[model samples]
Target chain A: MTSKQKFLYFIYLHRTGLSVTGLSLALLLFPLIEDNPYTLGLTNLIAINALVVLGLNLFIGYAGQISLGHAAFFGMGAYGSAIATVTLGMPPWLAMVIVAILVALVALLIAVPILRLSGHYLAMATLGLNFVMYTVLLQWDEVTGGPSGFSGIPYLSIGDVQFDDEFRLHYLLWSFVMVSLMLCLNLVRSGVGRGLSAVAGDEVAAQALGVNTRNAKIKVFILSAVLASLAGSLFAHCYSFVSPDSFGIFTSTDMVIMVVVGGMGSIWGSLFGAALITLLPEWVDMFETYKDFVHGGILVLVLMFLPQGLVTGLIDTIKIKLALRRRKNVAS
Target chain B: MLRLENVSKNFGGLPALSEVTFTVPKGQLTALIGPNGAGKSTLINCMTGVIEPSSGQIFFQQQQIASLPAYKISRLGISRTFQNLKIFPRLTVLENILTGLTSEGGDSMLMAMLRLPYLRHRERSLKLRALEALDRFGLADKANWPAEVLAYGDKKRVELARATVGKPQLILLDEPVAGLNAEETATVAEQLRLLRSAGHTMLLVEHDMDLVMEIADQVVVLDSGKCIATGTPDEVRCNPLVLEAYLGRMGATA
Candidate 1:
């Protein structure tokens, strides 16, 4: 192939790697520019939540599956690690790996029948699942501290290189964040991604296109659950605490809202969404009593104006305008 | 290459098709013509496994496929276009065709995440094939455009490209030119003829009698899901039973 053709092919393979690179660069640079412990801690939390939201996006955003009980997977990961370490006496890192696998298997089992549902039925199914997970976490206090929450979780360390410092933790979280983003980006343009998009657009038509719609939905759901599990493990380690309240139906709904406000189906858009939803509350703290009102108003306005979330809507606008300009140029 | 035996479909105690049997010969173009509610779409659905027949067997390449789902049937070298456009509206035109290409490594997330050489190799080959399909449909320049923005006729062409991009053993076209002008219909007809000449077996469910007669080597007529007539275009054209079924609207509609 000629140089131009080779360049085009590269883009066809990656669908433009510029955004992924930009995200990596900004994530790496954010802490260096700030350096404060509070900012770093907040950054780590954003990364953690973004990680969970990333998993949610895989199901809700990319594959067009509705999940309202993602926090159950998140909670399971947290509690899964706690039980593995405190009860089983396994190492922290080993607990993390095992929890992820366990959660994925559970998700696969749960998804088989649930994935068969469409539209509101699927949403309701997931919503009920969250309640079941939360109830188990509360009543089964023998391991989960009886809804009061669990503490004394061991800090994660890798020999001499400990993730103890706030700055190190921020780096650690972003490291996983960047890797997850890379994997997601690659998957989005891959066959699985297109298949998910196809399933989302029209299940019947996607099936007609030779896409196994239910199987595709189940695979993506398992992946997102695994991702949420990983994030849950990290969340427990980050605070050195675990709780049922942290992984409840409300959090599950919040994750869905983040996926929507971030831009459904856009990985880059989710990052912006995670940052906005996480930081926006802090930014509005001055209102104290009026915070909820202000925060909700701002979100409503953003949706009313941008509609498709900020990043995706902006990108689409630019693309449409560019196309129109090209046509105008040709005509004039 | 495709055969249906004793096919019957009933929706909630109402029979849509009953004991419909037909054969589409290998390496030839066959047109299925019927009036409104003649169960043409239902038959297409049965042939492509979109909906299971109430009773009967569908054979493709001499294998029973009536039990298979739509996706499995397509993977087994049977593909179809919808009476209404079913193109992935948000996807780029090229992506729509690429979705049908069925590259091996892409089906697995790990292979995709690692960007394995084999997956890359498949993508490169698939991209070229998709671009070639776009070119054949006169859609090369519009390959990057979202399919929803294409003109109606162009969307039909895109659907055709998507169906045949997999190089299936049989292509099922349901109302391929229902909403197109004469010029657009001519363009699509020419494209179908090209596929037929290229040795691709096609089963077309269409309404335009003129185009059907012009292109189909043989024609099958259905009324309320029963095979009313099956013969060459000339033979079916002169059949008194076929004319009477038209209910006096026959004229040039034949």
Candidate 2:
């Protein structure tokens, strides 16, 4: 095969690799051409948000577990890292790793009881959990600084190089996003991923086929919680701020909405959903007063027509159309 | 070999299966036949650890497996199919079979996420076995298609292929040929016979008396959670109690 043909074949073999590479290139070029700090900041937020949603999507979308309290875990990461550095006297970079381990344990303990619930019960339980976390963040004045919010989160530095520049911070965030995206891509094709999908499809059937559904559910839950907490840690370091209002119950609900709007089980849906949700406010700014109304209306349309979420729905439709056209060609 | 000793399951004071005792000899097929509420499903559930028996011990290869979890019991070499057809609808045909056969090395999260050497080794072996299974079931052509899109009989065959591929010592086939046409039912019966000839123990819970008579080395009859008869097909056919139970139920319904 020609080099072009060989490259095309390679793309076909590693489609997610292709998409991630293309995305990285686009993200790299996006800020250089358009040097608006505000737009760059928004893109950075999109990457961060996309990271959290990827875990949330794996939990709800692939594992079929409902989580409405991921914001609590996210807050834990932010506060955990902040407290570790500010009070515990840990290194700024080491604090993220330390806080991640602490948050993962907390998530495991919480998930034991939370995962016992099914469907709407699980949603309600997580919703209540986010409220409790919000209340705690507001009430804990000494450590978290109460309603005024926690501040002075140190910038993450590599050796002597501080990520103080906006472009550099953006790159730092995307690096994590890229790792998370590739990790998720590998997970979908992995054995554990198949087991999770099997459990999601039917718990009894999965168990019959030797999949430990309970363990699978718990593992996915812990993984999701850890990701949310990691995102929180990144958020704190990314913006140098932490607030109870930022990790409210609505934020938890928003995470679920992102997964649903993206596609329930599609791996690429996380990026698509996060990007849409993050950029949507700017788009709706065109209709300044009726922003919420326009946003609600557009979301309703997306759901009404694409119940499986945009990414999977589009693919399914294309496959069906292609099959129909093939049959028509054969018939003619 | 597998044996169930005095296995009893009760739900809210109602007995689903009471004191059911039986043995499935190695490499032989035992047909468990019953009426609508004969507790055949409940028995299957107990054997496969879907439910803990209210009382009794289950022995597989002389090891008591009654208290084990369902998945653990499955790992201990018991596989089953659902009467309602519990195929994963969203997964493709090949994936469904791969799910059954991929339990060996790919189950570790770290191994899979890192694409470790062992995971690749398992994947390659599993793909070979999965392809072999599909070819055996004449499903190679439909391997890439989603299980939901398959015809009802084809889906049933896929479920059977999934249950039988994982090298389980004993397979519980709950109404394997239910909802199948005459030819399709014959094909499934032939497949069961092939499995038996290969020295795989099978506990077939089926209502098709003709199919049962054709393939069953031993037959056990159940009515109202009680095992009323156990013998060769001819012996069971001649048993007064078996005739009375079937004829009496039919007469009452008529």
lDDT per residue as tens, model 2, B1-254: 99989999999999998899989899889999988899999999888888899999999999999989899989888999999998887677888998886466456765577776667677778878989999988888778776776779989999999998898999999999999999999999989998998899999999888999999999999989988889998898888898888635654676
The digit string of per-residue lDDT tens for model 2 on A1-332 reads 99999998888878876788898898788778878888888988888888889999999888988888999999999999888887787887788888888888988898888788899999899889888999999998998999999888888889887877678788888888888888887787777888888888899888988888888888888888888888888898888888888899767877777787888888788888888877887876665576556556656877799866788778766655554465466459
Model 1 — TM-score against the truth? 0.94
* CAPRI-style quality class for the chain A–B interface of candidate 2: medium
Clashing pairs in 2: none
Give the number of the best model, judged by lDDT: 2
> lDDT per residue, candidate 1, A1-332, as tens digits?
99999998888766657667777788788878999999888888889889988878878877877898999999999999988887788999999999999998999999998888877999999999999999999999787897788888887887888787798898888999989988888788777778888888888888887788888888889989998999999988888788888888878877877787888788877887888777876776675676556556655876798766667767766766665565466559
For each of the candidates, what fraction of the native contacts does it recover?
0.52, 0.53
Query: Where is model 2 chain A poorest over a 10-residue stretch in terms of lDDT?
Result: A319-328
**What TM-score would you give candidate 2 relative to the actual structure?**
0.94
